[model samples]
Each structure stands twice: as structure tokens, then as C-alpha cells.
Target: MNFLLHCCPVHHVMVLLFTTMVAMEFGQGCTQITTCVPGQPMINCSVVTHDSNSDPPIQITSYVLENIPPNSVIYCLNDSAFFDTPGTVTYAASSDFTINDAINAVLLIRSPNREADDQITGRVTAFDTPDQSEANLQVIIIDVNEFPPEFIAPDVLQHSLRFTEGERPTNSLVGRIQTSDVDIEDSESTVSFRIKGNGGDEFNVTRMTVGPISFSNLLYTYDSPLDRERIAFYQLTIVAVDSISPVMTSNPSLQVNITIDDINDNAPQFMGDHMFFIPEGLEEGVFVGNVSASDPDAGENATITYSIASSTFDREFTIDSTSGILRTSSFYKDLRFADNMRRLTVEVMAEDNGVVPLNNRSVFTVVVQRPVRFTNNIYMFELVENNNPLVTVGNVSASSPDLVSFYYHIESPGSDKFTIDRNTGKITVQESLDRETSPMEMFIIAAVYSNHSDLSSTAIVRIIVIDVNDNSP
Candidate 1:
């Protein structure tokens, strides 16, 4: 075995001074032993500081073996700690010394624990036949923050939230966003927050300073006003990024769901004008028309109940609660059936059921009139000449408030020449007549009996007869 110093000029001087001190302290008791052991002249190499969290089998530094003997071997001796530990640091080897035995052999050191920063010592030894020599190696572990920040809770927020429809106070805390980083000693492990996904701009996350600190109290606030009728819910993502260089690496993200609570903020309105014209004498409980309205709210806040809030004849009219159907009430029979037109004004109310109920009102105008024989007051027809006996010359139509039967007859110049059907008010020629002797004029009276008496209406007909040449006298 041979003792040799292999290093740069700087470390070479430190190794000599350190060796002299150790030798003087221990005197001849530390003999120049020609054997591989723990306390030996450490060929001072460079000060090696490696990054923690590096992969296994990381290189610390290398040493060189000078002037080796033939058929001799060089290897690492067991250190008290990491280097020779069974699983921590195994498989240590120096560049093959046998192949180039005459020249200096480079020593290469490696360990499998790449993420550890514990300061430990390592050793390497050389052997020649029965002789051996050993050297001490110095290694320093530097901590590095490589892992990103993560949410302390689930990737999705566990708490569901809700807010009213309005602007929130400035800097008002809506909720807390919690996070953590595993790197304790790293200054760059501080976590900052950002909101993303849809409606991200509606909220603001608290800012954090750059340094090692807990990010568990990151509170979020509402930045913009809310309208439940326009937008009901929001789905968003919260991202936590470390203050370290290159913000994207290992950044954590999570989803948060929020809903806007409803409010009865809108009023009801009628679809059109409320005026209506109905014939007189309609039966009780018959539907007249509908009054409709709507609300801009959601759920129970928009559900509306209706009522006939006021009317000139309250006892004669009614409205449905759910459907808003206007109808004649049971007391409609109590009203007088008069010959003149009557007018009634009604007000309908629509109300919503919410945390705070709201209401609206609308006016309805109803006109009632007696039944008439026809929409038009006057009716006339020209008679064609030489018609068959049963030929219908014309028809007289009528309208009524209620379904009622009518009778027909020829009033003025009642003659056997023409007749009217009692059921249909159709006038037909009873017999063929000569234009020379017939009066050429006639009238029809359409009548319906009320209280066993005839209530009549009238129409006219003129028979214009043409002479045939074959009938010349």
C-alpha cells in the first residue's frame, strides 16, 4: 500500500495542515499503519455540496488513486453512517483501477438516496497484495424545494355556498381556501392563490407575500354584483401556485360550486287591455275570459296566486286562484235582466309566495247587452221571376245571449203567394204568381216569445216579375 495526496492546490494545503494537527495530537500512537481502516490521512478533495431530492445514485465527487501496485485492488471501506449503510448508500465504485494500473485511477462515488440532505462522511481504500491504505471524504447536503403546493382539502371544495342577489360589501370574505406545501425549509415554498374557470372574474382571492409561510387562511371575496334571475349558479376552479420560479410546475387546482339565492324582485302584468263585451243573461259559473300575468323570479318566488280583488258588481263575477279564469259567480242569476246595456269594472290581483311576498293589480272592463235578432239591423232581398213553389228566396239570421228558439211569419201583405219557415226564418214561394195581378211587395217578421208574448224583429222582400213574350195578350 502507498499513501498519496490527490487534489487541487487549495485543498492540498488544507489536507497537509489537517494531517499534521491530527498526527501531533495522537503522537506515535497513530502509527503509519499499512492497512485499510477508519482514521486515516484524508486526501482533501474539493468541498462538495449536492442538491437534496436528487435521484438515487447521485455523484458527490471523485478522488484519484496515484502509483498503484500490480495485481492490487481499490474499493470503498464501510463508513459509520450513510455511505456503507445497507440500503441507504450501496453500490459505491471507483473507475476501474486494474485496467490502467500504471497511471492514476479516478475514484467515482455514488449513492441511491437522492432526496436526503443529511451531512455524512464517506471513505475509499486501496489494496496492494497484503498492504492497504484508506482516505476520508467530506460531503455536504443542501436542501432544495422541488415539490409544488397542494390543497389541504379535496381537489373539489367540500362546502357548498349561496349568496343573495345584490352587491356584496367591499373586501367581504366569502370563504376560505386552504393549501399546503411539503418543503419546510425552502423559502420559495410559499403558496399564492388564483381563481379560474367560468365566472372567475366575479371573485377575488387574497394575495400572499413571498416566503415560507402557511397558506391555509387564503380567503376569497365577491368582487362583482350578482343577479339570480340572469345567472343561477357558478362553477369555478381555484389554483394554488408556489412563489418559486416558473409558476406552472406542480401547481394544484380545485373546483368550487356556488349558487345564487332567489328573491321576489319582479311584479306581475296583464297581457292586454282588460275590457270585454259579453251578451246579457249568461248562465252562472260559465267562463268569460282569462286574465294572465307572470313573474321573473324562480321557484316559489315566481309562483303567483290570483283573485278578483275588486269589482263594481262583486257578487256577479269571480276569478280562479290558480288559472286566473274569470267567470260569472253563483249570484249572477240575482242581477236584473234589463233592456239596456250595463258596464262593470273589475280589478284582479296577483300575488307571489316567497320569503318576502310581492303583489300587483290590473283593471278589467266588462260590457253586457241584451240579445239582438242579428248583428245588422236592416235586411233585404230581390226576388227572381217565375220561381218554383218551394224555392227559398232568402234567410234571416239572429243572435242571442242564451240559446233560444225563434218563429217566423209574413207580417205586412200577408198572402198565400209566399211563406216563411217557422224554425229557420227562411222565406219560400208558396205558389207561382202572375206579375200582372200580384201586389209585388211583401214583409217578414222574425219573433221570439218572451213571457208568452211575441218580441218581434223585421226584414223586407220585393218581388220583381218579368213578362214572357209567349204570354202576350
Candidate 2:
């Protein structure tokens, strides 16, 4: 009977060892723990073991893994002695992971996100028939530089800004740029900004903190003066980059378009000499002269209009507002009747078309002149015969209303007997004369003319020789 008992215990031990070997070969069983040998009877046990292919804790980088299949195994759990006795092993985990009942494995149902936390702690429970085992399934999510800096404020990706030329002061804030990064905090903190393009020389960027939360902002400021006449438009690109090694820049960079507006900063200026001359007795609508002005501004600021501001002969002259042509008005008359030489002072104004108009004034001197004429047409002069040479005789005088000097000459025959002064109309005897040789009453014609005019006057002069009778018969 004792031999029988020993044989029966050996058989039971062999059967238990066979079941454990089969469960281990299949790799879908509990932990194989030998409590007895060939001479001892087996004790029923429930044990859970980790598969060689799976580790207790799983590790991966955030945002690196994508599209993991449902029920994807991250960890495997097995019972070593399930073949010897009827026992089932079930697996469970925290919210970060799920259990696959068919394979008794832990699955990565939810991906690890470093944004939530760097480390995730989850309990993986393995439940056997009568006992359960719990293991910490720690998921270490590594941080990675994934996304580049992105612009958020200045909500529109592209911007257009306008300012009047010379209106904005240097270092004035023109715009604000705000950016965000979806990466980890360290990456977001390392974001910086810069400007690129041909127009960058006129602008600058500065970092600033705003709001109670100290939000980061990039301020776009004017660095140089803007002139609409010089440069009217500017194009720039705004780029954002992180300070991390192998820096990442923003994709599809932001654009900044700047436009310069015009202002009436330049006043109209008169051009050329402002002196003019016109003759008297000019008909109405006679073109006197033209006055012109120029401005170095654009658009309406440069448009010019002309007018006669003040004049000595105000009602006698008229000026075209658009063409700047000055003309005689209906009130114009012969100025020579009033004054032989008349000079008029005219004040001309040139104004620009602007919101607040600007103007310039200039003075023009206009002179009026008349034809030269004499005051007398006839004169009488008396001289005695047998007078000594160079003897003075009566003078024949003439004048011009134009205030011009005259030259006189004798135009009649027998004039050589007497000489006349060119500057003054004084008659003098050239030689002694007797009454028989020359006529008793001599009539001579004298002419007076001016170098300034072709018009002249003639006068008749009679010289009656006295009968001195100094002739030898």
C-alpha cells in the first residue's frame, strides 16, 4: 500500500510538470513555479508572468506614433500553470492603456502626450481565478521639437498699413505681432522674430511683454523717415524662429505691406523773372505775359492755381487762374494820356490744391510807354547881317512829351551861313554877310527829332538881316 501511494504521487507530479511545459511552450500561461518534484504531489497555484517580448512599463515619444491599430499590444501577461488546472488570466490598465482579453495583453489605446505630462503612471492589473496582480505601467513621453512658431495676432496673415509721409515719428509703433507654438513650453518660450525683405532697412522689430499675464509680443516700429515723393510703397516679410538648435522657422511667412500717403508740405513757388512790359493803347484781351509756379508734391497737393492778389492797376488787368496768362481788361486805357511813362506794381499769388491749401506771392513790375513827340511846330529867330562869326542869334526850342532829348538841324537852303548847336536849338552866324549878297529877310527851316522815335517835327525860322551896309561896292 505505501508503494502504491508513492507511485500515485509520482504520477501526479509528472502530469503537473507536463502541463507546465506545454503552457510555457505556447507562451500563453501563468508563471511556472515548481513546489514539488517527482516524489512529491503538486500543489494547485495561480501565477501571472510577464511575456519576454513585453516589458512592464512602455515608453514612447509624444506625437511620434500615429495611427496605432486598435487593440495594439504594448505589454503581454501570461499564466505559467494554466494547463495543469482550469484558470484564466485577465488584464486591465489605467485610462492610458487598455486590455486585450484574447491575448491577455495591455494595449496602448490612448497615445502618450507630453503636453499633458512628461510621465504617466498607470496600474496594470492581472486577474487570475482567485488572485490578482498589479504592476505599474509607467509611460515615459519624451518631448520633441515638432511644430514651428506660428503667428496668431494681427489676426490676418497678411497686413496692410497706411501712414502719411513724415507723419510717423521715428521708433513709433506701426504694428504688433503675436505668435504661438504648439510644442512644449520650453520650445514656446524660445520663439523669436525677425524681418526680411528690401524694405527691412526702413523698419525694426522689438520684443515686448504685455498684459497682466506677461504675454510676449513683437512690435514693428518705424526706423527711418518716409517720403511719399521718394518711395510710395514697401513690402516686407515677417518670420518667426525658435532659439533651439537647428532652429525652425515659420512656414508661409507673414507679409506686411506699407503705403505712404501724401501731404501738402511743399508750398507753391513762382518761377522765372517776374518783370513784364506792355505798350499803351493796347486793346482789351491783349496777352501781357505769363506767370508760372511749381510744387514738388503729388496729387492734389501739387495742383496750382494763379491769381492777381494786389495791383496798382487792379481793374485794368486780368489773369487766367489755370494757365497763369495775364491779359488787359476792359478797363485798360491809354496810360500815356495820364503819365507819359507809367509803371504798375502787381502782386501775383500761386496757390496749391490741398486739404489745407498753401500759397506763395510774388511782385511783378509792368511798365507802360508812349511814342515820342514834340511840343512846337513853328519858331522865329532873328539875326543881323554883317555879324561877326559865332555871333549868337535867337534860339528855336522844341520839346517832347515823352521827356526825350532832341537833336536839331537846319533843312532849308542858305543854312550854311548860320550854324546851329545839335544839343540846343541856338542859331549862330558862321560868316559876315551883306544885305546885297543875302536876302534882307531870310527864311530857314529847322528839324527836331529824338533818337527814341521815328517821328519828328519841322519849324520855320526867319532871320532878317539888318542893313548895316558894311559891304564894299
Candidate 3:
């Protein structure tokens, strides 16, 4: 029985050995372990030292394709599983975007990503050829600031500053974003940010530095409000570039709008088409017209002034300033034997207070009118010294060129003014006269002699009143 027990023990040992060897073919550390980082050589280690229960834990680190070309076959001894790999492992990023295929097959970097602290995690499937896959490794690649600095939150960029003629944003922080690849924190992975948008007057990158920031330049300065009073607003673009080129993800240059504060720059000016009107029989001093203009500038620049450019009217016409009025400057006889004229051509000017001193001027024309006059006085005697008067008196005689040679009919002016004998041409006063109201006056009118036109030389006449004294002074 003791011998039987020994044989059983030997069989049990053989069974245990077989089971351990079989298990070692598939588990960690029985044969070789491949460290994912730094391309460490594959090594064979005893299975007992496998870290199945380590504390902080060791995970498969970021692995890049070794010296092999893309689509080249590689036999892998990872932990204990043998995986034959072909084709390149792709580093998938966010939705719909990825590192280029060429970058995928080798160690290449992604531009500035939208965030930091993210892992370059992706699926690495082993394929026998570029077109086929059998086993897959969910590889996790650590991330650092492989991407340059950029603005991200809000998906918007903003800046504020006092604006001048050439003013713009400078060293102020626009914003910050994350990266695509993570290297050791101390490595050159901390990419720097900069600007190319400031383009000075030509829209050069006027103000730029190697970091994320916000600021303004005094290149353009203004002591007063902007010329918005002259022109209203402006649009500008700002640019941002990076220290690391491939690490290009940055806020695109944003457009900024600036509104100019208004200040007066123009003055009121008058249009050229001005006209004048002089009332019929207008008094010499009566005002006839007014003037006006417009200003393109504001405030004090817009104020206006009025004056007589050219007034044909005399002192009789006057103008009121604020009301744009024209009144009689000095009253004058509206009635005159001679024509009264108020016609005039004149010019006026409006000026503005700008550095260049701008001004507006215009011309206007005025019209004048005249009146009629009459002559007075009449005399008479049996025989006077060749004297003629406008009216006839009691015993005196006077005649018109058509009426006198002998007589006249009351149907004509000469007959209406004097009663006359046709044969003797002796005329007498037909109506009483008042010197003040209806003073004796002479009027030369053509008179007809024969039934037809028998014209004669214009003649003279005289009329004397017997002084019945019907008129009162």
C-alpha cells in the first residue's frame, strides 16, 4: 500500500507540472514581456514575478511602430500571447478628424488639440496584411502639451481696449485650449503661442509675443473723440500663430468692430441756387429775401450765420437775422415818376473750423421796379405869351392837337376838359378843379381832325380862370 501511495504521488506531480506549463503559455511573465515605452528589447522572465496584484498598477504604455515600414509584418510577444501584426496602428482623435495616414504609420504629432490632460487612446488591431485584422489591442498613449497654446472655450475670441487711429489688441490673453499628444511635462512639449494678426497699418501682426495674451499698442493715439462724427465705424481682423508649426490649432484671426465717437467737424453751408423777390412798388428799404446753407460737421461745426450777399433793395428793406426775415431797411416812396429798382446780384460765404478751414459760398440776384409821373400847371388870357396849360378856365381858351383848330366834342378828352366853339376854338372850363386832389395837369394825347386820320403838328394851349375862386388851398 505504501508503494501504491508513492506511485499516486508521482502521477499527481506530473499532472500538476503539465497544468502549470500549459497555463504559462497564455498568462503574464511565463516567457517574455514587452514594455510599450522607449522601444525596450523584449525579455524573458520567470512567470512567478508577474505583477498580478501590483498597487499603482502598470499599464501598456504608448507604443510607436519600430523601424519596420508600414504594412510590414512583425511577430509580437506581448506578455505571453504571440500576435503577428501587419499594417499600421492608427491614432484616432475626436469625432470625424484624425492624424493623416502618413502620420499614423510612424511617430508624428497632431496640431494643438482642443483640450489638455486627454489620452491619445485608440484601438490597435493586428492584421496579417494592410487590409485584414484578427486581434486588437486597446492601447492608451499618455498626452502632454504637444500642441501649441490656443483659445478654445466658448469657441469664441474677444478683446477690449481703448481705440485710436491705429490702435489694436496686443499682449492680452485671447484664450487657451488642449493638446493632441502628451510627452513628459519637462520635455519641449509645452508649445508656445504667438500672433501674426496684428499686421500694423498694413494689417501686419502689429503686436505679437510668444504666449497667450491680450493688450493694445499706442502706435495710434487720439486726444479727442474719433472721427465718427466724420465717419462712423471700422472693421479689423486679428491673427494668431504658434511657436510649434505642426501644433497649429489656434483661434483664427477674429474680426473686430470699432465705432468712432462723434465730434463736430463740419459746418452749415448754403446751396448755390438762391433767388430774390422785390414786391411791386416796394419801399426802398423793404427787405426782399433771405439765405441758408447746410453743414456736414456736427456741434459747433454745424452752427450757421446769415448776411446780405447782394441786396438791390435800398435802406427801405431790412432783414432779420434769426428769423431769416426781410423788412424795409428804410421806408422810401413806393410811388415815383422814375422807375424804382431793387434788383441786385450778391454773394455770401459760410466757413467751418477745421484744421484745413473749409468754406461754402453762393450768389443770389434781386429785381427792382419803377413807377410813372405826371406834369402840372395851366394858364390863360385873351392873348398870352405862347403859354399852354393842362386845364381851361372860364373865359380863357385851350385846345388839344385834335380839338383846338376850331372846336371839340365832349366824346373826346379835350372836349371833356373844356367847352369849345368849333369855329373859334374858344374853350371854357367844364368842371371845377382842386389843386391838391385833382391839380391841373397836362397830358399829350393824339387828336383826330378829319373823319379820317388828318394828323397835325402837336400844338400848345393856355387856359386862364376868371378867378371865380371855387378851389380852396
Provide TM-scores for the models. 0.48, 0.43, 0.34
Instruction: List the candidate 3 regions with Cα displacement exceeding 4 Å.
Output: 1-114, 118-207, 210-230, 234-257, 261-267, 283-287, 309-317, 323-328, 332-342, 349-361, 369-473
| Model 3: residue 455 alpha-carbon error in angstroms | 39
lDDT digits (tens) for residues 1-473 of candidate 2: 01100111112101223223223422243234323222122222222333434453222211112223444444445443222343676666788778766555556676555556655566766567687655555544434445678877665433887878976643466766667766636433567767777567666655654553433433435454678877778788888897643467899788888888889989998898677756677889988889989998889999999999999867779999999998988777654436733778789999999999999999987766454333455555556666788888767776655565568777766577777787777877778867666655455544443442334566666666667656588
Candidate lDDT values, in order = 0.54, 0.61, 0.36
Tell me the tens digit of each residue's lDDT in model 1 across 176-269. Answer: 5666655433323356667776677767666444475433432434444677777788777777776644343334467777788887787765
- Kindly give the stretch of ten consecutive residues in candidate 2 with the minimal lDDT sum: 1-10
Q: lDDT value for candidate 3?
A: 0.36
Residue range with the least summed lDDT across 10 consecutive positions in model 1: 12-21
Tens-place lDDT per residue, model 3, 402-457, is 12232233333455655655444445555554444443433232323333222222
Backbone N/Cα/C clashes per model: 2, 6, 63
Reference-based lDDT, residue 432, model 1: 64
